[model samples]
Target: MNTDMTRNDFRTVAREALLAAVQGLVLAIVVLPCGLAFVVLTLVSLAFVPLGIGLLTTPAVLTGVRALADTRRKLAAQWCGIHVPAVYQPLPRGGSPWTRTFVLLRDPQVRRDLLWLPVDMTAGFVTALLPALVVFYPLQGIMLAAGLWRAYVPATGESTWYLFVPVSGQGTAFLAAVLGVAILAVGWRRTPRLLAAHFRLTRAVLGGDAELAERVRVLTETRRDAVDTSAAELRRIERDLHDGAQARLV
Candidate 1:
């Protein structure tokens, strides 16, 4: 891949990923209240434990699912470098809440995203763990090793140590520490690229020909609307001239 293109794509994907993370965090936060409410409702139901809990948790779960789906949609757009329509298809006229909910549940995009969110979340969590481990574990091990070396290395060893004494064990430990730090630096540097690649893969798998066709259709309609608007304005101007100035002269 072109490095510049990849960098640009990473920026876009990173923005969307951060937004998705925020959305997930928000949904997770919102679930607390909903969970409490569910608990209360379940207590009141007093029977059919599974069904009661399911009914009570449904709203929050559905909200979370939708938020995740939206995140995926945005990520898909960023990854594909295409603008996904933000506007949802309007509900059918006089549709009831149940009908709308059912329609959403049946939406291909929503189902795809619902299926993907857990995996995405897992990927994100794993990615995050890499830096933490690469940084913290190495630092911790180095500190422990250094302390052990310092305490245990014979202070009066080798005739009170030469001016440029090179302790083999200490040198090996220092090299290992340096290597760990290098690994961490490299991992941190590569994280954004990894994330972007994952996002691209996700977009490829979840984005279909139908979605692309819909986007093209939307763009076509938008251009047509713009042309019609310009023509309408010209007609209005002509009508105004004919009615006002031309008619007054006649």
Candidate 2:
């Protein structure tokens, strides 16, 4: 891909991921009260068995974490134009339910995803703060400008109009305002890049490539073992038939 195009793709992916995150956050905030209520109700029903509630909470939390990881992977593939192989292998049917559940719990990718959820949430929260400050600070400044102008402009003391005019108070305020706006704009522009960097860093630290290589190695070993076993079985069948038929003839 062209470097610029790749960057653009990454940006699009980042935007989608961020948007998803924002949506998740909003949903969490909105649903948190109701969720807590449900938990309380469950606890009451369970006679306040704290352990039971804790057990239930674990799966719910893990499920949410997995969803976030899947969303990230989808966004990465669709927008960032990076293809990552699925880390999960389905088990054959006829296995016991417990065995299947155990296999799922042991999956490295799922564990990594569980670990990443909190980190991603933290990063998203921090990234959001910059934009929030940018919006709030300028509005505060505007409010202050009006009051400051009225209070000091007609006073007999040192002239303060320099604070607002091209050569006065107005000029100084304008500069400050411009600086604030610049900071806000820069923060908005860099949010996507920061998100992309976080995604890449997490993938690297979590051993994504190592996991993939390990899976490939296991597959190769399995194929080799199957071939060997098949050859041995064939040899045994041939020997048995030959020995039995010859002995009977004798």
> For model 1, what is the error of residue 174's alpha carbon versus the real structure, in angstroms, after optimal superposition?
3.9
Residue 134 accuracy (lDDT) in model 2: 37
- For 174-206, candidate 1 gives per-residue lDDT tens digits of 655565566555554444454455455455545
Best by TM-score: 2
lDDT of each model, Cα atoms only? Answer: 0.51, 0.53
TM-score, one value per model? 0.44, 0.53
Cand. 1 Cα-lDDT: 0.51
lDDT, candidate 2, 1-250, per-residue tens? 6999999986785565455445434433433343344434434533423445534444444455555556666655554455544465455587654455445557776666645545544553454343344334554445434455445545544544332433136555556456555654555455445445544544553436656667787998899999999999999999999999999999
- Against the true structure, candidate 2 reaches a TM-score of 0.53
